[model samples]
Target: MREEDDKMNEHALNPSRMRGRRNVFCWFYSKCLDAAIEKKWKHWNCAKCEQRHNRQAEPEISLQVNHNIAYYEVSVKY
Candidate 1:
């Protein structure tokens, strides 16, 4: 840890770092839980959850790198 831990500091953010660490086989939300659970949706729509939710309601993941660890924690900067 460094002295800066005592205070919030500005840092650049990137998403690529977490992309490599993600489970490629995983879906943001499981298919079984989809609204079409009974219909058995055969194909992924190739959409940003076009069939899932609105743009704003879609979930988001953020990666924060601290000493090479990510998803460790995230915060909003005032």
Candidate 2:
């Protein structure tokens, strides 16, 4: 009871510290997909470090789409 309640509170607070982590990855993945579908190069900066990178010739375009689908599936499952 009380211990379970404390654990729940800890879990709730943990994500606030991890805010924007998932969004950054999702945004980057989507930008890469869009670049591939449009046949153009896209650039992205790291959310944490601001390092620039380009999506010029990714070999796993299909894998990115599959990953996005899997993420959605997991969200729905939970």
Candidate 3:
């Protein structure tokens, strides 16, 4: 039990001692989300959402996507 706890603590402290850990998957996902946000914000044409926005002219974009972008922006800074 003591040995196992020591190993776990060592693992936790190693990352802090080193540079840091990067989740490539999450980083890519956030980049894609940022692109989507920029596209929507710029009123650029999106293949999936292009026609939908054009037809309505005034439509509510997904709040969840926007929220995720906001969260990612804050996270990537630090």
lDDT of each: 0.32, 0.36, 0.33
lDDT of 1 at 46: 23
After superposition, which runs of candidate 1 have C-alpha atoms over 4 Å from their true positions? 1-33, 46-54, 58-61, 69-78
Indicate which candidate wins on lDDT. 2
lDDT digits (tens) for residues 1-69 of candidate 3: 465346434542111112323232221323324554665643322223212222322335753554535
TM-score (all chains, Cα) for each model: 0.23, 0.19, 0.19
Candidate 3 lowest-lDDT run of ten: 12-21
Model 2 deviation from the true structure expressed as Cα RMSD, one decimal place: 18.1
In candidate 2, stretches whose alpha carbon ends up further than 4 angstroms from where it belongs are 1-26, 40-78
lDDT of 2 by residue, 15-66 (tens): 1212233233332444434443465434332344221232433455465444
What's the CA error at residue 71 for candidate 2, in Å? 20
Each candidate's number of clashing pairs is 0, 0, 0
> lDDT tens digits, residues 1-78, model 1?
243222212321111211123222333333323523455544433233222222332336644445766446778999
